[model samples]
Target: MAERRANVWLAAWRRAVLDRLPRNREDAPWLWILAAQAEADLSLARRMAIVEVLRDGRPHPAPDLQAAVEDRLGEGCFGAQVEQTLEADITSLRAWSIRIGCSDTPGVGGYYLKDPIVKAMDKPGYEEHPNPMQAQIYRSMGDARKMRSMFEMFEFALHQVGIGTRLRHPDWDDEQVEAEVRRLVTGIEPTMG
Candidate 1:
């Protein structure tokens, strides 16, 4: 019976990790939180704080690791990026957390696990039009070509949103630009919907 229970927990943990992939791919901050929370040594409260910070700000570059450590542990510690910590590495973190009695199940677990945070982050990106102009610019670009390559679509989307510069090439024909816009809009609409 004990062996069966252990197997069940392991299976559940695998599923939970797998489920986190889509959200991790979409929202960078959520990914950082999941990676950070996976650290076994860090308490759940600390993990939550890290997630909040990442969601609101930029990723910590190597030079900024000291400040990040100070923010998390308060001004005086030692370490690398949070992800490099032994507590954040998967195999060690998972086993250690289990050993220390953090529940494998969702919600009941002491630390906020990856799945919920990912799901919650997923909600706003799709539902709320936080940046309507950006969304509109992407919408203007026709779809088929953009769908063919996400990189192209992303670049087109940014361009329409008036990012980087007013226009990189001032001499380009208006008809050509309009056609490109139409193409992106048509392409992205189906996917965005």
Candidate 2:
């Protein structure tokens, strides 16, 4: 029981750390998790290390990727080396299908980014990006920032304090939800409902 409680607490801690990053308001928690993971990946030296390996849209050898990450990070403390974990990060990038995607080769464990995002990022400013893929993603997310923020705020109120209104009026419909929403927003009940 104690061990399970600790695991639960650890999971919540991880969730909170990743939750603050920017993402769509709808299904925000999972979205933020993906966004934060991608952002952290962008910072990893292995990201650049495997670019060439994965560049041709063909699978490359797993050892080649490990060596790339090793070379990128350089030898670790006391001439010892750090381990390679680039494969997992690449797998995660594949999971964020809307922002980016990838295809993996089963025979030799090779991978490459999906075509569309590569094409999008291949535009003129691609080289200029601190991280080209992230820049490409920001292009789409930029348009939705304000709207997502507003909707997130409204959704929070609707399910948060709105829970009380729901409990108070068990038969409430959209009309009631909208009424509570407006009341919460303006601090004034609608003149007519």
lDDT of 2 by residue, 62-149 (tens): 6555555444444331122323345455654456441223335444355554444534445566465388786676576765795896
- TM-scores vs. true structure, each candidate: 0.22, 0.27
**Per-residue alpha-carbon lDDT of candidate 1 for residues 1-193, written as tens digits (9 for 90 to 100):** 4234333433454356556676554445654455445343334423333443334223334324334434544432334454454245333434545322224453223322342232336456565656888777768877874576687766677567432222754665765555445544554322222
Best by lDDT: 2
Q: Which 10-residue window in model 2 sums to the lowest lDDT? A: 75-84
Clashing residue pair totals per candidate (backbone < 3 A) = 15, 0
lDDT of each: 0.44, 0.53
Displacement of residue 27 (Cα, Å) in model 1 is: 30
What lDDT does model 1 reach? 0.44
